[model samples]
Target: MKKFMNEAGSLAADSLDGFVGAHDDLVAFGQDRKHVRRRVLSPGKVAIIAGGGAGHEPMHVGFIGKGMLDAACTGHVFTSPTPDQILGAIRETDNGAGVLLIVKNYDGDLMNFEMAAEMAVSDGGHRIETLIVNDDIAVERTARGTGRRGVAGTLVVEKIVGAAAEAGLDLFSLKAVGESAIAATRTMGVALKGATVPQTTRETFVLGETEMEVGVGIHGEPGRSRQDIADAATIASLICRQILDDLEPAQGQRILLFVNGLGATPPSELYLMFGLARRFFEAHGLVVCRKLVGTYATSLDMAGMSITVTLLDDASLGLWDAPVHSAALHW
Candidate 1:
């Protein structure tokens, strides 16, 4: 709760204002600060919009720019954006090729984005499609009763889908590409420490110095189990096993290995985990063709990291390599 904010009620708005001000050349606030969009819109291109709760910085918002998301609607900390906010983004960004909404598979996010899509078609006369990303393999379908939560693998979906949209792909085509990417991706995370919400002083969960939360969710949801903390190699092996077992890629499959820090982890440790994870995947007969390591998706200073395994083909690899200019990712 030691956040640098004047008040809890205005935390989201104030943060948005600062972010917009800093990246004024790259992005601008959507109607009434409901969302953030690329300052220079690409007319006639299929608009790619992604959004979810805040706290996971440089995510939906940071990915908004050339060759990526055209607009990103954000909710309050760890809260889903309203349907009205989503609809406004669609209406404002949709040029002529329609829009594609890249949503994570959280209950609030799914419902709100779906409602906005319906509204856009019926009320605004805009063609809209939605791609839901549920890449977290931490829980079985029965665990949360909402299927696996979308975790860090969302970055892979957004980048590939965004490139496709920027390349003039139609709404349906973009949806197909995004769906395939979703099908090929899987993610799992571990938490060394829980995050403290801006509104409260208590951490999301308490852990002893020697303990860790395995397969934790971005919103601090409980993972499969909590156990004694192990070394990086041991931890990386367990996580890699979960992801590879779920994804089930063929032998020699070229893959993109992404190591994402959950808010508080540092780059030095991130790279160490990445190195270990890469070695583990390579041992399983998978080719570590492309890799990304950074604090892309986070949970409000939670000390942990998630590993994402994405099976990549030539087309998808090209899309991932395509030019992108955003606050968090660029190439």
Candidate 2:
């Protein structure tokens, strides 16, 4: 129940104010307080914009900079930004080439971003394209009617495709690269504890000290099951198995492994999880082409980790290795 600020009534402008002051070099708070996009500009190149809720820090906004997202719109915690906010970002970041929206496959995000795109095209006369990322294998067979949900793996797609856009790739090519990256990525996560929304002042879910929630989504949605907490190695194996099964990377296939912290999981634990993931890949005959382990994407202070494996070819690998200078992620 302990929290610092009021989530419901706390204006998005207040949050952006603190963020911009803290990282002036990395971001510039837009004139419209509701819209916060990356300040870095790339003339003659297509701009990339993506965003959703606020709690997923360093995501849509943090990725804004030289090599990642051109702009990002932040909504309230766990809620999608309004269409107006998204449209403002498009108008600000769009150059003559075009603007691409990297939307996660959530109902609100999809709908709101789509509406903004339509508005941008019809009213603003801007060329707009959209790509939806749904890489979470945990919800691959969701009973909620839809298939998989987008989770931490979205960071991978944004990084890869953002690089392509920065490299002067056209809108069509950028969209193709984004879709390819999403298609090649698969993710699985386990939650140790629930996160407290700023406004609620209480944890989203109750879990016994010895229990863990497997197959969790970022929004504190109920996971597939609750089970007794196991060793780090065992947890990593479970996550890796799901990712491998869904991705089905062949022997000798080069891949990128991301051990992402949900929010509060320590780096020490993440490294341990990475070790288990490495062993799993080695056993499966898959080569770890590149590895990134950290809290790249998180769900507030939720204690959990998600592993994303991107099956990569030369093009994808090159795109991934491209230099990126962002607030949350660099190089």
Candidate 3:
């Protein structure tokens, strides 16, 4: 019930206004509060567009800069952006090389972005490609049911594919690289406390002083189950096991490990998680090529952390190592 914002106003516009004001060099405000940022539109290189709810800051918009996304659409907190907003971003970012929509696997996001893509094609004959990220291993897998959800691993996919596009890769080749990165990435999360949305002046979920939720989503959705609070090593072990079970990284393979904080979790806790994750990877004979630790992707005010691992080959590693300058992440 503790928040510091007016709850009876337009959350989306207010948030975007502040974001654009602070990062004018990296981003600009577009119609309908969309985020328009300059991108490297090399001839024959496909444009990249990504977006979703507003709480996951520095995600779609934070990534809009050199060697990353071309533009981003910002919806209300915990809600999907409308088709028109998404279409506007596509139109603004498109430079005749076609556009690629990087969508999360949430139901609302999938439906809305697909509708926007269809509209873009029907109205302007702009070729649009899409890559849906679904790397959360905590969710169920069924052909006819809601598959895995996209979590922290999405940033890695976007980073790799963005580099490919920046290097003037064609749409087909970028799609291939994107799909490969998506397939190789996996994520799992743990929540120590719940988050409060600005619109709702209350916590989304409840947790006792000595309990935690494993495999929690970024939007405060219920995770696998609650468990007694344990030490950081034990918690990291549990999360890493789930991700390793899903990905099965080989002994000699190089991997990118990301320890992401879900808003309120401090950097110290994230570093503790990273230490344990590094041990686990080393014990399994996996070569840790690079590691990124911070609140790259986050929930509103959720006190938790998520881990993402991407198996890397030479080409994937090269793309990931490319220089990237964005509002949230800099490399």
Using lDDT as the measure, the top candidate is 1
Write model 1 residue lDDT over 1-331, tens digit each, in one string: 6777888767777888898899998999998989999999998999999999988987889999999999999999999999999999998999989999999999999999999999999998999999889999987877646798898999999999999988989999999999999999999999999988887767999899999999999999999999999999999999999988888889999999999999999999999999999999999999999999999999988999999999999999999999999988989
lDDT of 1 at 201: 63
TM-score of 2: 0.96
lDDT, ranked from best to worst: 1, 3, 2
The regions of model 3 sitting more than 4 angstroms off are: 39-44
TM-score of 1: 0.98
Cα error of candidate 1 at position 230, Å: 0.2
Best TM-score goes to which candidate? 1
lDDT of 2 by residue, 1-331 (tens): 5645545557354666787788788778665676666666879999898889878876777788888888888888899999998998888888789999998888999999999999999999999999998988777565676577888888999999988988889999999999999899998889999988777768888789899999888988887789999998888888888878887777899999999999899999999899889988988899997999999788888999989999999998898999999878888
User: What would you estimate as the lDDT of candidate 2?
Assistant: 0.86
How far in Å is the alpha carbon of 207 misplaced in model 1? 1.0
| TM, every model | 0.98, 0.96, 0.96
Per-residue error (Å), model 3, residue 56: 0.9
- Candidate 2 — which residues are off by over 4 angstroms? 6-8, 11-13, 141-144
- The local distance difference test score of each candidate is 0.93, 0.86, 0.86
Model 3 is weakest, by summed lDDT over 10 consecutive residues, at: 35-44
| Residue 91 Cα positional deviation in candidate 2, in Å, after optimal superposition | 0.7
Ranking by TM-score: 1, 3, 2
